[model samples]
Target chain A: MAALNIKKGSSSHSAYDLRDFHSQAERSHTLALIVDNEAGVLARVIGLFSGRGYNIDSLTVAETDHKGHRSRITIVTRGTEAVIEQIKAQLGRIVPVHEVHDLTVESAAVERELALFKVVGGGDKRVEALRLADIFRANVVDSTLESFVFEITGTSEKIDAFAELMRPLGLADVARTGVAALSRGA
Target chain B: MSRTMTGAKMVVQALKDQGVEVVFGYPGGAVLPIYDEIFQQNDIRHVLVRHEQAAVHMAEGYARSTGKPGVVLVTSGPGATNAVTGMVDALMDSIPIVVFTGQVPTFMIGTDGFQEADTVGITRPCTKHNWLAKDTDRLAGIIHEAFHVATSGRPGPVLIDIPKDVQFATGTYTEPRQARVDHYKPRLKGDIEAITRLVELMESAERPIFYTGGGVINSGPGASQLLRELVDATGFPITSTLMGLGAYPASGKSWLGMLGMHGLYEANLAMHGCDLMIAIGARFDDRITGRVSDFSPDSTKAQIDIDASSINKIVHVDLPILGDVGHVLEDLLMIWKSRGRKTNRAALAGWWKQIDAWKEVKCLSYAPSETVIKPQYALERLEALTKGRDRYVTTEVGQHQMWAAQFLGFEAPNRWMTSGGLGTMGYGFPASIGVQIAHPESLVINIAGEASFLMNMQEIGTAMQFRAPVKQFILNNERLGMVRQWQDLLHGGRYSQSWSESLPDFVKLAEAFGAKGIQCSDPAQLDDAIMEMIEYDGPVIFDCLVEKHENCFPMIPSGKPHNEMLLAADAEAFKSGAALV
Candidate 1:
């Protein structure tokens, strides 16, 4: 039935694509990079994105191989598929970057982020905050007479839900370490 | 196996080891030590310029003309800052140049010391790569690496900032052979499966066109030769970008001239009407692909480039072969021949018939003026006079540059140099000087507009000192013709700040600089004036006054597609926006 709709044309190129090229949906992608642990390498990577008008939702970097002087940077960015591909290619062109792997498509990756939420309240709001924190498996890292600081580690979505629950319960301040991701299996 | 020497001496030594014969630079306070080393050395020659910017431009001209990496040395602060424009210009055009800056003492780097600037930080985005040598022991190794990075894979400018203290300190001198450059090896040869697939596509491409660019020249003369051979073997039409003009001879049977915004009528029409588009060593820059979504909508595209990032960056291609242009063409040619060199000859003949009909438009034609020289007429005369000589041409950016690209016929690679990517004004005069310096006997010319000629007219002094017999052929249109043309067409003729008023008598200025100058406005006297300029043994500036309102035609308006080009006949109608109706 699908073959009946096929139309012959002068051009040999086909419009059928695995991913629709015409669709302009913005998507989130997590990319892992291995780069030389040298001075100004981070600046070069960040500058490329900023210079080219690409957006970074979250970014985290640390030296993974101390002996070899190699650092791993995990970046979560949002763009259309074509823009994402360009971002990855541009990242790979940086001199110190050795590898850029899009973990979003390469594997069923595990993503985690650590965040701290400080809730300041004096009455029912304080109790409600504690109850929600206990349900989400968040530990009270610091406490006072009227305030409590909860530390939570989870996927970005889970943490977002937890933060939403705390917002109505007198969420005062929040700090998040950007996402870090790794592949699931060998 | 290594000898210890001051870092300044190592800087000079590393340049020699890298086979750099000339250094275009200006001496400064922070660079006195290195200048002293340059003074002590006889193996290398340094050409001093009046300003730091001209030095870099001169080096770019030398590099582009000779196929060797140009070298530059300057001081920190203002010196490094002045060089930023040329560095970015070279970066945009993929010209291989190594710029070295002398910095303040290490301890005073960030303390607002005299003549201090964060050279690495300011040039990070513009340069291919850069380094600030903090250790004297690593200076030579880093210098060698800078040269390697500048010339390798998709050649571009690179910089290294050497502190004054580091230059004074002693270090182990490392030979270029001893430098560790193992990490940065770009892929040179294409994958066999992809090459075979491309050959299959080539065999069946009825309306195929080869769109080549500057990468062919950067890959060396052999790549250009291979390109010509491939074009001949396949019997396909070829067109080039502005930077790739000389890669294929304009006189070739299959040549369609240059294609882009200001391209020939038939070449652009062929691009729009082609079934297969084979891009060799060319990026699909927005200037080449106006309205990208509608650009060659039906073509099966294939791109061959050294930089992997350039593939699928703009227009996605069906086949992306990541390799050097030379190697890929060599493989493509061999496999194509092994398969009996098949082609869709019947369909190609039809395509040629269409192209020939379009060529009948004669888009480059203009009415020859008797009073004032038309810019096009001037360039055509210049071309007729210097067609077959050992001539090198550079141009300042404007309508005159496009006219030169249209009228000048380049027979071989490396004979044409212009600021294609950056569209820089004031590039041609010093560039012509550098080319003259390198090839002392070649007939070098800087095609200029009157407005752009004044931007770097100071280079005449440099030419006087060096005795470089470069010719400056200025089309004195008395206006910024391109800006005024755009204003007339797109902005309702409110020509603001486009007039070249209060301009100097260029002939008097040239004579004042101890060089010969000739001024001519009559169409009949153009050939004689050009002859006088060419025959002079010293630098000559020919200010040829031209028609003020003349515009370059066959233009695809900024947002329009290739098929909607405005030819010379449609210029007036299009300007009135009647063509849209």
Candidate 2:
């Protein structure tokens, strides 16, 4: 029973619809994509995600070559074996996606995102905001005119903690590029 | 080229150009500004339905009766929610309707503000397509697309959820959207080899029949003419489902009448005994087919429809032709013409003789006495009054509807408008009004029973408002005639208020609703009353009293064989088939 291969070829259909089944064992997968990082690029990708009702946990991107070149986007989403096949098939069909694969199948990749936050202060309120930012090891990029722009970089959780601390004193706004990840344990 | 005034005004103008003479709507918090703009604009009248549900139904009636798209408007939140049922009804029946609902102000959206609903998301399943117009300039184009989607192919409702802010914000709204289709490319060409096979089969078969359906009418007059040519050439026995009533003029030679639980006995028997059954644009619905395994067991079937999905989805076909019924029938006609296989009168007369005996003893089992008027007697009178003229008869659901479908022979298409699919209770009155408006010169009548007459008595005013000379025949039996008959047969007369406790005088009710009324309690009075009502310049209501619990004769109860039916007289001798008592 355990040897039953319920993969892509298990059924005659090109895809299967059994994502609702729950399992205890956790599995992880990753993929890197090259895309024209222009206006609405994010929206198109989000559309692909939402249309099939897939959930994405982490996403990170950058124009790595910087010759006004293409962008490298790393996306981390979870699914069962059948869902993974569909994701690969659907992602391959997208207009701008150069290629897609389950990196977990090939066994290699890396991913990350940077976040910045701003909070206002200049009195006792300012002192409290500074103290909270310091404990989280967030570097103070600039401080003046009753405000401070704190730069925080790390895993998403570390940035989250720093942002929470700044919130109590005078958190004004947050800018998150979300999480970007690559294949790990190469 | 010159840039025109902003998009919002163009939207209203486009609606006027599209011949959208009326819109049913109610103003709300978000749509007030657009309402103000529309109020200032020229053309396109608007009516304030008390509720959004009424707006959709009215649109449905307008679309169904006129074969044109119905347009509706409503403001957002609960207003849009109210329209869901009407949209779904239109969806089920494949009626064309364009719905415009206001959304919350763009900035105020996603907040828990007043009158905000995710209308686009909610209506996606019910509508063929929906648009959320982000700017006023695009509103005209969006409305144009909505109309196209609503009317094209197998028509269904399309909704446009307009944000209040978008309507208020100015943008260029112009562009005539040509009719564009994505998925529905129906095959018009028939499979020649398969059609040839059906022809060969039809030629060889001794007892052949044609079972036409509502799809023939939906395919338009071309479909009806092509089918009639085939029938006339072959001289085949013919029958129709309830929806297919007017496809074959009921008074024609080949017309074997309706085949169902409440269908003609001769037609039902021919379905069982026939060699080749040309199932044209008809599905084997449960009501018509009786039991699944026994449905036309001896017949070799040839089926065709515009929707490929419907083909082979129901009963199996020995020779299946998947394409538009109109084109296929034309191709079939050409094949026969090429072969020069004209009518064989001798074989046809023999079959007709057999059918005549069945019709005499097994069918047409309505008993008529001097004092007691039968439902079939009223239908016969209605038929005689029309005298085989082109007439539009819309009816409410019941025993009377069955009798009308049986006795009232129809010769025209779209001339008989009944709620065949949805069977909405109040459909008859408004639909009759809509038909009268479309065919102003033609005699239009709502052939409804007392129970159904009360359902939408208000729509009598719609006829009165337009000064339409529509005759409403309220078949008063003092009981829900069809239900009571079923209770008599099935429940041993454990009738649960099938008879009205205290029935209101519908003649007085018609007067209250601003329509002229005539009361006829006797068959002798029927002719004069009908003549006076027909000659009247305005809408008239005829409340005729008839005997209660008059069963639609040759009735096949559910789950029974179609041929095993009860005659009007001889209740116990249904199987042997009895003549009228």
Candidate 3:
């Protein structure tokens, strides 16, 4: 797992500097949402984000409990601290949403994303791709005369790094599953 | 004991169980079944409005004045779209209203059937909550829940879109008590620690001010009473937002007057200078807090509101007490009394002295003319005549609306209803009709500009038919006064499309609707015309012509700090096309 090094600071000065200066910069956060598995619930959540002009970088959802009839929706979004807090508060207010936990704020959470990269080349480029894949612990899921598909699952940052390293080595195409996150505890 | 009944019957039954006494509506093709059910019922009195938009405003007026959830019923498509403005207005002001919009049959909904609309989708952002009931079994419960959601925490408008087939289909009815709505439970009690911190700050502060808003009115009558008690006990100067007028009596000794853009000069100054600012039931709207960074630069602000999300959303506060206004005020009062009602009285006297100096400016004063009536003078005369009586005032958005806020004194909560948040132009006439319905014997007046009055002028038919006797006092400036003012000041006086051209003779128009009409231009005839309108047994439209270019002032230009407010005195030098100071 790796993290992106993004520039961080307040872009403009404010007279009433009531907020902590360090938290004013935009940062990515993964939020775990617990909601009722009901019709229109997902649309309502999506509507709120789109209507308000808030950005959602990644999202994934599925039913988590069969008996309880509850679903978990994991979303990765980037915003300032205040904006993130506002998003959490707003999500909690939706009638069908049972809970909203921001993994960045909770500080004890795991995040992972799966990616499959298809690399096509002849001699040296193909050999280097195989070597890097072994070092990154990625499996070669598919092989053809001209291409080898390497499957990798890890944090979003790690996937980004692997994809960046493979780009120059005949990386023909790539497919990624959006980040899915959960809080780690008993 | 549940019995199977048509969905339309269930809606009426649910409204009855919810204690709804009046419903403002306009019927259409898709709502025939609901209208039939309404006709068969005697418990719920339905007032047929002239337009769907007016129906929603009427409901808003009824809700704001009566402290109860206003109810509206409108048919599909255009009807739902027309009601959008009023719903947004109610949402902005935190007025509770439950609107039931008819939709096309289930199968015909997505196919663009006659009068069909995506009502739930359009209204989702504006309403506190909304639903499209596809199943008749869930229709009754949804109706009950709509009432609950609209009238509950930080009360606002909600919508329930009922398909025609659902109205015809038979479903098992659920009583209000039997409905399953356990998900929502808002915090009603204030945090004791935060309250204590606020009390300590209040007692020790030399310069403190209480800035209140519409939350007190929405928290019910008890909240206003508690607020008055708190203000009296503390002996601190108090000012309120436009929506919060009448929460504390305008005549109260401690009242500094309404604060914000177009607010009293003293109040704005107090807000800028106060060391401890206690914002009760008020979200610091941008209009109130000009230049967010520069707003109350020296104050240690504390806020108490029912909505937690409102806290720190814009202006951060030192203490945020999230709770219902009434409960929070009650707790604060108890703690203050238990601690011997401590306050820095000697320091407060000095603060009042400074406020007195600011009040001496007489920011509301204007040069009066004998031939042409001044808009402010008309409201003053209206106030003089209607004072000490059961009177409720509603206002359309613009210069006249601001003048009404400046001149009319409110002695109690719920007596003044205006479109504060969304600032919808045609709100007051229909709202006045609704208020008149609520208090049949009370004097109901909609202070409107000529252009604004024309937007919902058709509602005169509703007033005439219902015998509402709502007074329409049109300050006939013959212009969109506020827009013209902005053009005159900010837009280099370009004045594009601000004139109210080819307007009908309001007096003749009123007569056509079988209502009394009076036209007055002379200042001398103003009193008589106002009295005549008040004395009329039915609806009266009084068109009082005023000075053409009178701009509402003591104005704070948008994005300027509070201390930099431009007063009426400053307007005299700038009248000759010179730049505003």
Candidate 4:
């Protein structure tokens, strides 16, 4: 019975420093992991992070690229040096997980997280939020209450750009899953 | 993995593994399948609350009563929306709760189907994490992840919206997988350099003080016992905020009394004069710090907590130890152990001498007249009676609430349940009902002021329906005590109709609800009233008509500290000696 492939150690060293993780909003990283499709696997992964007081900025899971027998997970988190290593090691321990890597950790990787941003504005600002949404290739899901909910998917940086544009235009709230990624080409 | 299981079955099994005993919920269209499977099961006890909101609050009460996370379940649209208030309440207080709401079929998700609303979308801002499960295979994992998110990282509420189609779908699911969080880590390890420095400072400071908060207990009980050690060693006087009520047993030496709006004057003064303030797990909330700029300005503050954001968020810290309180205290204790240390009581002797004099003067002044009953006297008896006996006591929101919290010297964590952060007015009855349900074997009491008693007086019938042996003690002053007290203190007693209209016989109301009721007036009648409640098989009420114009003293008068209290309940210097002009 190959229950766990990733093993925590007698001296399990974590990836990042515990302090100043959340405080670094700009430097904070969100990584989405892609893994083999299996049950109870996600729980094992989340339990590892939460059992300790590690925070997840955003998380989303879905079955993408079914031909490869895989699923995509977008996770937003913050940490430093030793903390990042611990996260990868723990994910690899799950039975159904084939690999675990932070899409934002290395230069070769590309990361993307989806956000449905809701903004409330009137007059000129409403026109501005709409024009910016068009430029970002976002779809409007709902409107009224002097607001619009725009559904957009791209790299977290792109989403941030869109949100930043909407900020002056009346960005009320944003709901996003940190990031999800897959290697380019076969 | 098993082939015979459906997704809903696997979820039920997973909740059992997570050690969930009580589940508060209401059933609706989308969640019928889960309820069907639940009906056939025997392990988890399901409570049917009157509304979806009540289910969430009941879960919150259960969580507060027990030190574990509480679970609430509801169905699509309105049912899920009904939980919004409870969810926000839990979020504000940093309580651990997992809310499960049923959703419409996956095929009908976006086509405006029956009872369909984006449960996950609605809850995104308020929850720590949320899930929209279309695939049944991930059901167990989602539940597990929801629990992990809610209980971990500053503790909060999480929501999982399960579509009906997914629940009925077949899937081979095992247990939830535990994943590691690479970032947003908790500081279990303290800075050795900072900790030792504070310990050395504690050893020498002439007027050092120890102030603690709810964070101490959150760090765990073993950590709290260290308070006795530090105080015994340094002889520093101990004071606390409203939320830090039970960090220590009330009747101990070196205890300066509570500090804040309703705190003892000496404790507030001592806080100001102390050269060093050792604060663990407490934020300098405006209620505690008063006019922040003036609060203990001369003292060097040492702040410790698990949340890093809280480090410099409140009062500026000279020494900020960002880590779990339990871990930090244990490390300090280890360092203290190697020093061959013994408690030094010299620093406390003079302070205790001053406090003792203050206590005597207070007792002489506030002594109840032959005719009127003192509200504090009732609480004093309550404190004496419940000693060592484990009980759950909740209070309606008002002056009596503060009085109970101030006087109790609570011996355990979670023993006192009231809306501390939210301060909900009508939370008492329902909260008491929830507590009683959680601890069926333990006696539950709801201490209510005259006005706070009316917030959910309707629940007396609910208590009767369960034949729940819960007691309600009404401190009847015929007015909203706290509001009137504020008006008296700050508004020149303009008394803006905060007082109640002519009273109803609460005894009759209790009788109407099929429960026993008693009226109490004398201190001697206290034991008999409480005993009569113990004898009753169901809900009971104790009405003690107290003095109409009484005030809670040893007052810290809003922004003052340590020695600046009104000094006693009836300090003559605070009064104008001449008769009304």
Q: Estimate each model's TM-score.
A: 0.96, 0.71, 0.95, 0.72
Cα deviation of A160, candidate 2, in Å: 37
Report how far residue B523 has shifted in candidate 4, in Å: 5.5
lDDT of each: 0.89, 0.72, 0.89, 0.71
Q: Which candidate model has the greater TM-score, 2 or 4?
A: 4
**Candidate 4 per-residue lDDT over residues B1-581, each given as its tens digit:** 35447877866887898899878888999999889888989898787766676677667778877768889889999999988877877775667889989999899998888888878666755566677888887687677777776765467788889999898998866565543233324447677767776776666666677888777765656666876666556556788766666666566677766777667666776777677888887877766776666788787878876655455444666676767777888778777666655334476466567656655554214666655668888877776776677688888778888778766767666777776666766667667877888898888888888677776676675566655678888899999888887677666678999899978888888888788888887766777776776667788888888888777765656655434556454444444421132
Candidate 2 lDDT over residue span B384-406, tens digit each: 88766657788888888888888
Q: In model 2, state the lDDT of residue B507.
A: 74
Q: Give the alpha carbon lDDT tens digit for every residue of B497-517 in model 3.
A: 999999999989999999988
Q: Score the docking of each candidate (DockQ).
A: 0.28, 0.03, 0.22, 0.04
Q: How well is each residue in A30-142 modelled by candidate 3, as lDDT tens digits?
A: 88888888766788889989977799999998899989889999989998877776677677667678777777766588899999999999799889999999999999999
For model 1, what is the alpha-carbon lDDT of residue B160? Answer: 94
Of the pair 1 and 2, which is ahead by DockQ?
Answer: 1
DockQ of 1: 0.28
- Over the stretch A31-75, how does candidate 1's per-residue lDDT look in tens digits? 999999988899999999999999989999999999989999999
- Of the true interface contacts, each candidate retains a share of 0.31, 0.00, 0.19, 0.00
Residue B531 accuracy (lDDT) in model 1: 89
Interface RMSD of 2: 13.3
Q: Write the candidate numbers in order of decreasing TM-score.
A: 1, 3, 4, 2
